[model samples]
Target: MRYGTRALLSKALLSLLLMAACGAQAHFQELIPSTDILTAETGNTLALSLKFTHPMEQGPVMSMAAPRRFGVMGPRGQEDLIDRLRPGGTDGKRTFQATYRAELPGDYIFFVEPAPYWEPAEGVMIVHYTKVIVDAFGAEQGWDQEIGLPVEIIPLVRPYGLWTGNLFRGIVKQDGKPVPFAAVEVEWRNDGSVTPPSDPYITQVVKTDANGVFSYAMPRSGWWGFAALLEGDTPLKSPDGDSVPVEAGALMWVQVRDMR
Candidate 1:
C-alpha cells in the first residue's frame, strides 16, 4: 500500500466520522401527546406519538423499533400500555402512536422506554426514557409522580398549562434519586417557520445545580423537549460483537401556549 493512498483514505474516514458525530448531537426520544392539557372542549381521547429524531431539524428521523415499555402513571396508579401502541408513520418513516380516553379528571403522565438503538457512528447504544404529562379537566394532581424509570425528569413545576414565558423546571433523577449537576439539552420542535442559524442554535444546553434541578423559560409557544443525559452503568453488545457504552437519556416534553 502506498503512503499517499493511505493518507487519503484516513482523511476520508475522518470526515465521515465527524459528520456522524454532528448528526448525533440533537438526537431526542420524543413522547409527544396531542394536547398537553386536555379539557372537555379539547377532546375525550388523548393521542400520543413516539419517535426518535432531531426535533429542531425535524428531518432525517432515525428508525425506532417497538418500545420496550409504554404506559401511563396517574392518580390511580401505573398502567401497562405496551399492547396499546400501534404502528404509525409519516412520509414512510416508522413511528408509534397510541390513544387513551381521559376517564377521570387528573394528571396522566405518559412514558415510553424505547429499545436500544445501535449507533455505529458514536460506537454506543442509545436508549431514552421519555415522557409527557397531560392534565385532564384541570385536575393537576399527580403531575409530579415519579414512575420509577431508569432515568427520568421529574417536573418541579406543573408540567402542563403554561404560558410561553413561564419557567419550566425539573429534577434529573436516575434510579429514583437525584443526579446532581446533570447536563440537560433543550430543543424546540421546529415547524418549518424557523431555521437554525448554526448547529449550536439547534440545541440549547444547561446543567443542573447541586440539587439536580434545572430551569428554562421558553420564549416561544410550542413543544419544547428537555433531555438529561446519563452514561449507563452497563454496556450492551454492539453489532460488531464488541461491548459498547450506552447513552441513557431522561427526556420530557412540555408545551407552552401563547396568550390570547
Candidate 2:
C-alpha cells in the first residue's frame, strides 16, 4: 500500500510539472513595420502593428491595453505617437496599429512601452519595451542608435535589409548596463502557412555571452524578433493586489528576405 501511494504521488507530481511546461509558451511583444527598408516605390507612410503574442505559434494574441508610451526617434528628433494609436485586434484578441510618414531619408526607430501585463501562470507582471527600425530612402543611418529603453537590445547589426541566413547580433542591456548571460528568445512571425512540428520548434532559445552579446541566424524569410528577458529590479503589483516579480523584456524586430 505504501509503495502504491508513493507511485501515485510521483505520477501526480510529474503531471503537474508537465502541465506547467506546456503552459510556458514564450510571450513576444511584436512591433513590426510594413517595410523595414522604405523607398518612393513602397511609399512614405509606414504602417506598423503592435501585438502581444507568441510569434512562431502565431497565437491567440493576448489582449493588449493601450500602451503607456509609443513614439519614434528619427533623424530630426523624437516624436510622440501615442495619440495616433488605433485600437484593433486579430482573431478577436486586442492589438494596435499606427502610421508614420517619413519625410527625410534616415532611420526611424519606433518603440513602445507597454503597460504591465499580469501573467497568472507565472505569477508575474510582464513589461516589454519593444522596438523596430525602418530605413527611409536607403539612408540606413541611425539604425544602431540606442533609445535607452529600461531593458533594451542594442542591435549590433543594422536591424534591417538582410538576406535569409544572415546572422543578427545584439547586446542585452538593463539600466543602461550590459546584462551578461541574459536569456533571449527568438521567434519567426509565422503566417499560418508553416506549422512547427513540436513545442521546441516554436521558439528558439539563446543566451547572451559573457559580454552580453547574443546572435542568431535567420533560417527563414520574414520578420524575426529577438527578445532579451530579464528580471526587473523592482516588483510590481498584480491584479490581485499582490506584489509580483516583473519579467522585463527588451525586444527588437528585424526582417530578412529570401534572395530571388
lDDT (CA) per prediction:
0.86, 0.87
lDDT string for model 1 (1-260, tens) is 99999767754554454345444567898888889888879977988888888889987788889999999998678899999999888668789989998888999999999999998867778899998999999888999988888898999999888999999999999888899977788999989989988887888888899989999999899999999878776778998889766778899999999999
Tens digits of per-residue lDDT for model 2 on 4-105? 997677545534532343347888999998899888899999899999998888787999999999999998989899999999979898899999999999
Clashes of each: 0, 0
**Which predicted model would earn the best lDDT?**
2
Give me the overall lDDT of model 2: 0.87
Q: After superposition, how far is residue 40 of candidate 1 from its true place, in Å?
A: 1.5
Instruction: Kindly report which residue pairs in candidate 2 clash with one another.
Output: none
